[model samples]
Target chain A: MFAGAAAALLVALVLALARAVLGPTVFDRVQAANTVGTLAMLLLAVIGFLTGRPDFLDLALVYGLLNVLGTFAVLKFFRYGDLGDPGEDEEHHT
Target chain B: MNTVVDILSWGFLLAGGAFCAIGALGLVRMPDFYTRMHAAGVTDTLGAGLMLFGMMLQAGLSLVTVKLIMIGLLIFFTSPSATHALARAARARGLQPLLATGKGPSKRS
Candidate 1:
């Protein structure tokens, strides 16, 4: 059962990768990348259960946290052109 | 009792996998970035929730189950915030969502 779930997640991961590759815009790639992170995290947890190693769940939790942070960081950079910006009104240029 | 638990766990795992796959398909087939985000939302919430619930059942009342719940909570809190930020940033940068009427690029000249 765990193997089945992992297989499905792998399929999803591949599809998301396709979207990331075929992006018409940078945001599309970012969105796809985020989805990929999510699928990978789920995959990690499922694999942990399948292997009877619950420690992988901890890894999945860490991965989930990092994925969100990474997405936010990338989006901030895309929006402000810098990682640390307290200024409220930076120029809005795509 | 053990058989019952096994059956329930299998059901949850399979359903979660199916939802995840469908959402990924939508992500690939959606017309634009905003639409793709919506598809991704389905996977983030439903797919991950069901999978973790299934695993929790398998783990029973233990620390593993607790960790699974923690992971689920993290996903629930962070996913929407990240999606919102991505959409907001895109909009702020003049990235107009695609309209259904087939109108040409909806950006200011």
Candidate 2:
């Protein structure tokens, strides 16, 4: 069962990668990249279970945190052209 | 009891995998960036949630299960934030969402 899940996730990851590569817009690629990160995290967890190595779960957790941080960093850079900027324009919308 | 657990795990894993695959398909097939974000959201939420839940069940009351829950929580909290940031950035940059007419792109002034 874990094997099946892993295989499906692999296929999904490839599809997401394809979308990222074929993007007509920057947002599309970022979205796809985020999806890819999510799938990778899932894959890591499933593989840990399959291998009976529970320690892999730690790695998955770290990866998930990194994924979010990376996305935010990239979006910040894209929006304000600098990660340090407060994204003031972004705040006005919300 | 063991058999029951096995069955439950299998069911969750399969369902999660199916959702993940379907979401990825949507990502490829969706007409616009906003729609594609919706697709990826599906995989990020339901797909990852179910899969991690199954792993938690398999791990039972152990540190592994604790770690799995932590990972799930992380994804739950961050996925939406990231998606929101992406959408907000796109909108702020003047990238308009596709309209319902499905005819052509429209920008908001």
Candidate 3:
């Protein structure tokens, strides 16, 4: 039964992937990416339970954090169109 | 005893799965970026919350349950913030929304 549920989620993931490939606009792709992240978190939880390890839950949590931070970073870059700010960025590096 | 919990979980997971599918379809079918964000929000909050709630039912007050709750909370909070920032960025760039007085999303991508 649980396997069946997880299988359904996999189908959803496929649909999201389709969006990522053909979304036309960058924001559409970003939306797809976010959805993918959420699904991945759920999948990790399910896998953790199924295998009885439960350790994978920790990984899922980390993945979730990365997912949000990654999205925000991408959006910031998209908005600014530059990953660095010249001397100010160089100062941080030094 | 177990039957009630089983039904609850099944209902939740199934409903959440359906919402996720619909959200993805909207991601493809919507006309533009902003509409896509609206659709995406549905999946992030409602779909994810339902699935996590179902999992919690099965989890029964454990560390896993706490983690699941955290996941749901994170999505709920961050998804809206992401959407707001995206929309604000778009608007600031002078991408006028094609709404009939804010009725629906822009009709063109």
Candidate 4:
């Protein structure tokens, strides 16, 4: 049953991959990348169970954090065309 | 027993898969960036949440299950933030929202 679901989501991931390839805009591609990140985390968890090694949850956690940070970084770069906004960020946040 | 749990997990998993597919179709079908942002928010929030919930049931309510719930919460929080940021950036870039006929922003350029 779990394998069936994992397969279904894998199909979804593949479809998203097609969209990413055909995306006409940068934002569409960015959204595709985000979907890929979320799906990767879910896939990791399922694979962990399939292998009977629950310790893989730890890897999922690390990957989830990385996915969030990586998405933020990519969006930031696309938005500002820079890794950091030295003036506006420091002033606005602090 | 595992049968009941399996039923529940499969249902949730199937629902999650449907939501993800719908979101992808939305990506292909939606008119522009802002509308796509609307679709993206729906996809990540519900789709990821359901898939994580299904996995948690299979995990049988343990520490890992708690972690799974936490991850869902994180996605719930961050997905919107990410979508909002994308929309704001799109607007900043002068990307226009798709509105129904005669429903666009009234203030003319």
Which one is best on lDDT?
1
The order of the candidates by DockQ, greatest first, is 2, 1, 4, 3
Question: Best by DockQ, which number?
Answer: 2
As for lDDT, the candidate ahead, 3 or 4, is 3
Instruction: Give the better candidate number (2 or 3) by DockQ.
Output: 2
Q: What is the lDDT of residue A66 in candidate 2?
A: 89
Residue B18 Cα positional deviation in candidate 4, in Å, after optimal superposition:
2.1
- Output DockQ, candidate 2: 0.85
Choose 1 or 2, whichever is better by DockQ: 2
Q: What would the per-residue lDDT of candidate 3 be over residues B1-109, giving only the tens digit for each residue?
A: 8999989998987788778777767777776677777787777877788888888898888998998888777777877887787787677656666454566753553
Candidate 4, residues B1-107, lDDT tens digits: the string is: 88998899989987886786677667666666667666666568777788888888888869889878877877778777777776777777777776666666544
Q: lDDT of all the models against the reference?
A: 0.90, 0.89, 0.78, 0.75
Write out the backbone clash pairs for model 3. none
Question: What shift in Å separates residue A76 of candidate 4 from its native position after superposition?
Answer: 2.0
User: Per-residue lDDT tens digits of candidate 4, residues A1-94?
Assistant: 6676678668768876876898777877887787777777777777787787877777777887887788778778877789975425665674
Q: Where does candidate 1 stray beyond 4 Å?
A: A87-94, B101-109
Q: Write the per-residue lDDT of candidate 3 for residues A2-86, one digit (tens) a residue.
A: 5765776788789889889986767667778888998888888777766777788889889988998888777677777765623
TM-score on B-chain, cand. 2: 0.90
Scored against the native two-chain complex, candidate 1 gets a DockQ of 0.78
In angstroms, the error of model 3 at B28 is 1.4
DockQ of candidates 1 onward, in order? 0.78, 0.85, 0.53, 0.56
Instruction: Judging by lDDT, tell me the better candidate of 1 and 3.
Output: 1
